[model samples]
Target: MTRKFTGLLLLLCFACSLRLAAQAPVQTLLWKKQLQARLDSLQRANGFPGATFAAVLPGGEVITIATGIADSVTMSPMRPGHRMLSGSNGKTLFVASALLLAEQGLFNLDDSIELYIGRESWFTRIPNAHSLTMRMLLNHTSGIEEYLEQGDFMQQLKGHPGHTWKPTELLAYIYDRPPLFEAGKGFSYADANYILFSYIVEKISGQQMYDLIRRDVIKRYGLKATEPSTKQTYKGLAVGYARKGGPFPVAGAMVHKNKLILNPQFEWAGGGFVSNTADLAAWAKAYYEFKAISPALRVQMREGVAANTGKNHLYGLGMQIRPGGEAGMSYGHSGWFPGYLTDAAYFPDLDVALAIQFNTDNFRLLKRAPEAYLLDMARILATQVNNH
Candidate 1:
């Protein structure tokens, strides 16, 4: 070959190689060696029946890895795409739906929730119901107690485990309870806030909350695996377990079925959704990273509570701000229900997002904070990516 021709061919090959390097990093040692190694130890150490974790790169590529078993009884391995209950992470969707509607001028966050549900019998007895604004509900400042914490209501749930309660029925537990404080006077996390917000969405949108979210948000964005599962079970869901042990907080010395008790309908607008690691990683980019709302509104949605409280933790509309969640700070929510633990976080500084779900939960029984574990998982992803 002529020297000139050879030089030209070499230049072309170099350019092609550069282009390939720019593409998403394929599966790496991060997944097989580091992540799997660490996650396997963590899962076994924590006693999780199965768990899944995912990370979204700055350029929108995703990596999902799983450990342990999906069903402890059957020993089925957890896969990258296996669906798990979303727990409180569903708050992200409910809040985002409300914000999107507000952005479109369909509603206003400052509007009184009573504007929609005041006439309903359930709200008549709820203290401060007429004075509560949609913003209060989103931020958990509405003074409404969470329905799940009521001993009487929980007894009913336990007594009739097979019965499903409608949204109004869930309200029965909240309506009679005394307000924790005057409207907007305090910060509290309450599922009742979102459940009631779902009512407002249905009233104004003239569709079920599930339909509105499905059509407007999840569908518009191409999240095929993420779906609201109120009362409808998805196939291949991972089995959840409650960790049992003597006193050391070991994960799987024994496990009990911490079956999800809050009927899906009652969980409404709060935590009744299902998703997998891959979809959640994509959803983080699509929904939280700009697929849905405007950048200005994203800032507004995450403004968090007043600074006077001096609290380390901050709660945004649907997200939580972990002051020390990453190399810089981050925003996301962690989800916990009986059998499932789900968590996802987005780091604006790193431009990376991570989602993780575990089939075992001992938060209530073992006093273990599931979010901390999930956050560690995110840190590992960030550490590996940054090193690579």
Candidate 2:
């Protein structure tokens, strides 16, 4: 066999071995101390102001650890309860809620979005408006341009941080824009697809998108600290710090004086939740373990397509599927906001779910990518679980 193919075979074998060894019960206290040490090392090494790490083991045992400062100016020590704006990670919750509605007979995945919001005056203005389906939106195959990538949208967002934007207003940037590609021809990640999805879900269910998420997803899963980023301030929410040379104009305190500088209500179905790593870890465990969705829908959610060429990852519905190497496959999502970066995943072979959140988005300062740190953290926990 070619070297590359041979390498793949060996990697799969190694992962299988790890999974086999992972049946031992986790020693929660030992795992917590080890995780904390790693978290502290990574934080100081990378200059991250603060971070939280959480994991849910095979039998529902949870371990959460925190390190560094939540608000540097106030010298607030980061706590396990501090919630960070989870960025696109919220997409997982949004997509699950949409699927829940479908399970309730409210809609079908193959149904054209036009069937619900097609009559609206602005509906046709969206690229590929007539041909888009709920499945395409869920899987991000709708060929829609990501509104967040548009210069005008970012300008407006940064210019008016407090503006409570409506969905149409956020979508106006891409009103007559061309699709990234023809629908179903290829994969292109786009937040605008989820925006249209929010409209469809709201229209069909006669409830606001956030309400649907809270009712059907969060409440059902008992994710206590997870909620819509609708309000400016939330108790125990961490202050976010932007990278020095980051895209965001504001450098520090994305959440200032206990209030978010940008009104996150506009995020809508496109990742609008702020949550602590503990709740996020719990949500990831429940969702990926098939407790949150039907096994049939769960299968559909795993039907992944190439998200990045040359990357060992795929995008499935709202989740990102990444091979966990010697650990197994991981199903989860990552989030990126101005001053925060978060990653969460469930490793099926090990039956472990992990969530990590950094209060500062200074990835350039890190020795490795934030996702890499999470996988490393997962491997550490996996080994611990195996040893015990």
Top candidate by lDDT: 2
Residues 1-388 of candidate 1 have per-residue lDDT tens digits of: 9999999999999999987676435534344456677778887676657788887777666777898888777788999888887878888877777777888888888888777877786667875877899888888888888887765775676566557677777767786678888998898788888888887887887867777778776887677788776653466678766455422222341222534333444566778788887777666655556546778788877778752222477777887877545546667887876567887877777677778888867654323565565566656666766765
lDDT against the true structure, per candidate, is 0.72, 0.83
| Per-model TM-score on C-alpha atoms | 0.85, 0.90
The 10-residue segment of model 2 with minimum total lDDT is 20-29
Backbone clashes for every candidate come to 3, 0
Clashing pairs in 1: 46-251, 47-251, 47-252
Clashing pairs in 2: none
lDDT per residue for candidate 2 within 20-101, as digits (tens), equals 5563333567778888998898878777788898998887778888999989788989998888999989998888878878
Which segments of candidate 1 are over 4 A away from where they belong? 1-32, 243-263, 306-311, 364-368
